[model samples]
Each structure stands twice: as C-alpha cells, then as structure tokens.
Target: MNKNTFLGITGLISCFFFSGIALLQAQSKSADLKNWPKGSSPKEIGTRVADHFVVTPHTNFGKPTPPKVITYPESCTWYGALTFAKASGNKKLTRDLAERFEPLFGVESKMIPVPDHVDYCVFGAVPLELYLQTNDKKYLDLGISIAEKQWGPPEGPRVKEESHEFYKQGYTWQTRLWIDDMYMITALQAQAFRATGNQKYIDRAAKEMVFYLDQLQKPNGLFYHAPDVPFYWGRGDGWMAAGMTELLSSMPKNNPNRERIMKGYTDMMASLLKYQGKNGMWNQLIDDPEAWAETSATGMFTFAMITGVKKGWLDKEIYGKAARNGWLGLVSYINENSEVTEVCEGTNKKNDRQYYLDRKRNTGDLHGQAPILWCATALLR
Candidate 1:
C-alpha cells in the first residue's frame, strides 16, 4: 500500500492500454491495404468479363426443336456484355452487340420478339450509354425510340390477351410490376431519364418502382416475387438487387425517393442475410429452407451487398462477410465454359412450393448470367 508501488502499477496499465489501441489500428490499416489491388482497376476487371462472352452460334441460338427455336438467354447476356464493353472502353464490342439487336427488333417470336417493349427498356440503356461514350447517334436514337414505346399512351395494337391483362392489373396486373420488372425495365428507364434529361422517363421509372415497392413489401421488409403472389422467388429478388443498385447509381444523391429506396434496400438485405444458406446461396424460395441454394439470387444479393458496403450505404463489417460468402457460392457454380449454371428459369407460381423446387437448372440463362457478372464486377471493384 505504498505510494511508489501504486504509481508504478498505474504506469504499467496505461502503457498496455495505449499499446493495445495502436496494435488494433495497425491491423485495420493492414486489412484495408490487403483488399486494395496493386495493378488492376475496375476497367481491367470489366475487360476480363467482356472476354468471357465468346458466344458460338450454337450457344447463342441453341438446338432447334421442331418449330420452337430455343435461344440462349439473350437479355442477361446482352446486359452483361454491354456492361463489360462500356467498362472497358471497347467501342467495337459495344457497337457489334448493339447492332446484333436489330434482328431481335425485327423478329416476331413470342419468346424473343422485337416489340417486347419491356425488354427493350432493359437492353436499350446499354446502347444509349454506348452512344453517349462513342458519340454514335444511331445507338442513342435507337435507345430513345425503344424507350418511348414503353411510355405514353398505347402506341401499338394489343397482340396477346395477357397484354391487356397486364394493363388492367395496374402494377400487379399480369404485367404490372413484378420482381423481374425492377431489373428488366425500371433501371433502364431511370438511366434513360438521366441520359436524355427527360423528367418523364425518370418520373415514370420512380412512380412504377414506388408502386412495385408499395405492393410487394411485407411487414417484415421482405418482398414477394409478385404482387398477386405469396411466394418470394430467387431471381425475383435478384431483379430487385440489381435493379436497386442500377437505380441508385443513376439517381441523384439528393432525390427525395433516394432515402426511402435505400432504406428498402437495407431492410431487404438485412432480411436476406438471415436466410443465406450455410453453403452461401439463397434458396429458390428465399424464406423456405428446404428449397435448394440458388445462384442467380445469391449473385444479385452479393453484388448489392458489396456495392452497398463499398459505397457506405451499409456496414461493410457486417454485410461484407455475407457478400463474400454469397460470391464464393455463386462462383462455385461457374463452369469451365464461363457459363453460369443452375439458374432457376422464370417461374409464375404464387403458391406452389414444388414448382419453385422443381424448376430446371444448368440452363445457363441470362437470368443467372446477368447476376453472376454483376456480382463479379462488384467484387472486382
């Protein structure tokens, strides 16, 4: 109990505390430096992605089965390739892909028709961006023309009964808003608005997106695949994942809807993280554990989570691990051909668990590929 002994002990404890703080700070700095690449840039990673898109005629067109001309999933591939081309500053790749769509626009098939205005909305944005980068008015004109079709009063005659059904559904009507619409159209519309300085496109995109958000969100922050359905589909969530990222990237930082959308995104991520399979993928039916772990949804979630963390929209320490896990799971499914397999094809069920489970795999559809490319691109960043 001497004063000298007490002072010596206090000095030793203070040194230990300061040293511990210094050690922790040093570790954090090392971790940050470790994540930083020494040579590669986002643009370089983008070029690698573009190089992966070496499509053969057979791969792109698929084997013909009688009257049905089964084609590779074109939309997702187009988007992924276009994204890579834009990122890498590859004008020829961008132009070639942009021109290839002319045939799609001229075709009349139900599966991949020219007048499928919804898809035109999704794929057109890349062409528009390409035009912006290259000063090619042709791409810009085509993109704007196709985009305008999605807006304004009905321009063309109704081809199918479902078309009218979608119109009547009013956002949940057969074609109103669904999980896929976010990815397929709304993001492109937002980009179109930004590129063209047209408030109409932005307003339309926001209104439709908000309507979809309002209709699909559950009390717990999870969204159903479709408004009329009780099910939450994997690619459906993927659509929202990519859609939100794309939309957020294009939206002005000060826009009023930005905060609401970000909250929705964060809430969705929070709900999603709890359900990630030990294997790192989400199930075909997200809320159901019995369903198989799926790649498309997991890739989209990975991309969204990582992008959110890097942009400071989400806590990197918490969501970053989840994102990394999902990315690893997704990468496990990639084949040597660079084709993404086991993507659940499009589903329409609102109540059937078996339908979700029984969906075919390894088809390498655009639905799967787009999200995978997106996840890879984000990870590379």
Candidate 2:
C-alpha cells in the first residue's frame, strides 16, 4: 500500500476502536440497578454516608437551639445509613455502625427524665433494627423503652384540645397532630412491632395514620402541614408518605387496617404524581410550581414509589417511571463526596404559606440523607 493510504487506514481503525468503547460505556449506564456501577450506585451513597457523615447532636423539637440530649430526628440519619449498610450486605460497615451507636444507648438511658415526646423516640428505629439483626437484647430494650413511653396519651392532660394546638411550643410532646409526627412516631412503632411481635404497636401506628388522614389529608390526596397551617409543605407530606409506606410494607397481612392504609398511600401517591416537576423532583411547596425543586421530598417520594412498585402495592407501569426519575433526581443532588444539597431545613408549622416557602435550605442534613439512603435501598430491591 502507498504510505498515505496506509496511514489513513490506521487512523480510521483507531477512531473506530475508541468510538466503540465510548458507546459501550454509555450503554452500561442503564436506569435500573442491574448494571448500577459503584461510583453512583445506591451502595456508594450508603458508603459515603457511613464513611463521611456524623450524626449531629442538635435537636429541632420544641426549641430552635441545640439541646443537651440527643433526639430522634438525629437518629433518622443513623437508621437510614445503617439500614442501607445492612441491605448492601457490607458486614464491616454494619459492624462499624454498631460500634458507633453502642455508646449512645447508655447516654439515652441516663437522660434526666427519658424524653416523653414521641418525636424524641423516633431514633429507636435504629436500635430496633440493630436488635433484629444481632439479636442483642440491649438494642431491643432501648427500642422498647422508647415505644412504651410513646404509647401513652398525649403529653399534656388536656387530650383533645392539646392535640389540636399546632401552635403550641411543646407541640412535639403534646397530642398535637402535625404531618411530620406521622413518620416520627410511626416508624419507631413499626420497628417495635417487628421486634416484639406485639399487635398493639402496629395497631396504634395504623389507627393513627387513619386519624391523621382524616384530619390533614385534603380532597386531592395531599395533606396539609397541620390543621393550623393550610399549606402542603413538601417535606411534611413526604413524612406522611414515608411513614405510610413503612407501616404498610411491614404490617401483618390480616391486619384490619391494611386496606385503609393501602388506600391512603395509593391516593397520596396519585396526588404526588401530578405535582412532580419536569426535572424529576417535587417542588418545595408541592402545589406551587414556582417553588424550587426540593431534594428531601423528592427522595422520600422516590423511596415510597419504588417500594410500592416492588411490593406490588402500586402499578409498575404508572408509578415506575416517576420513581426511577425521582431516583435520578436524588442522586444528582449527591456530590462525589456524598454531600446531598438543596434539602429543606427542619421547619415548624407557621400560619402563612410564605413561611414554608422562605425556609432556609441545607446541605448534608440528616433529613435529606435518610431519604436518599432509603431510596437507594429501595432501588436495590
């Protein structure tokens, strides 16, 4: 062959080889977890959380400032990360988490008067799961202790009135039914039921779901933040959905409330489907298209949708696309360092819609981290 012709042929062969490799790489990036690579997989997100994130001791209940005692929302990240680690089948990660959490039990037991607030007890979900995995009685004891306290009447003696006082400073401890409390109280109760095989834990969890749905769920299937606050705060609704998903997934097959819970969850999901933004995320204010896409709510919805489809509770054809897109939206917020951004910070019920709209956004907050880990674990299923 002539020198010029030989050189041209070699260049073409090299170009084809590189192009073929590029196409193969692109093809490997499938939507499902079948070929999910470690770099961006749900497992990696759990790993990042296990390696980098620390559970903050701050308390968001009843006070703006950090409290001396560790609280339940703080444990949301712990439960999420540990649950993800267990699902990933990473023994070292699980052991590391167990060690990390071991000391907290003592501290929790010695709290001046063990917290009476149901919100304070939410952290028990982690201990409950840990007990089930390792068969350790201490973990079970810790969880049961919290459950026993939360099982009683509302904190104050005035039951009906206190329950409806959404504006009270001690609403977290009171009988007040805010949308956020659904997850805070129910998640731990579900865990308690799993650990003890007691029907009461789940019964309370399910009945309370019905109660909240009647009080807060609107005509469109979305829930108001609270009776006092009329806005459909995205995270507030997300909490309700996440709680219902967890309870229904674990509730007994013959439980009388299963059908009711199922209906509520499906209805809320239908409403959520309509509000999801084009970017695969839900808005901070779900009904308000003008609000920015929020990560925590998106993560919660993605986890719920995927869980429903996998369990046959939701129709795959209808809800699967939204769930997968929601997963993509959540991971997009997770940076290489695994710091999730654009999470709406801890919020309280306020009278005006602008209060929820104007709340500050946070990064790597436990509120956001837990839902992302939950979504990651659901995708694995």
Q: Write the per-residue lDDT of candidate 1 for residues 1-381, one digit (tens) a residue.
A: 799999999999999999977854443333131143422233443454455653423133333442232232455566666666655557787767656654544562333434345644565666676666666777677767756666533445543555665455443122455677777666567767766887666655665677667778777677787666778887787778777887776677777677777777888888997898766689888988788878778878887887888788888777877776666566667666666678787566567678788987755555676676565556555
Which run of 10 residues does model 1 get worst, by summed lDDT?
A: 31-40
Please estimate how well model 2 matches the true structure, expressed as its whole-model Cα lDDT. 0.77
Error of 2 at 329 (Å): 0.8
Best by lDDT: 2
Which pairs, if any, clash in model 2?
none
lDDT of 2 by residue, 142-234 (tens): 788878767554555434555444324322234467888889878988999999999889987888778778777888999888887788889
Model 1 whole-model lDDT (C-alpha atoms): 0.65
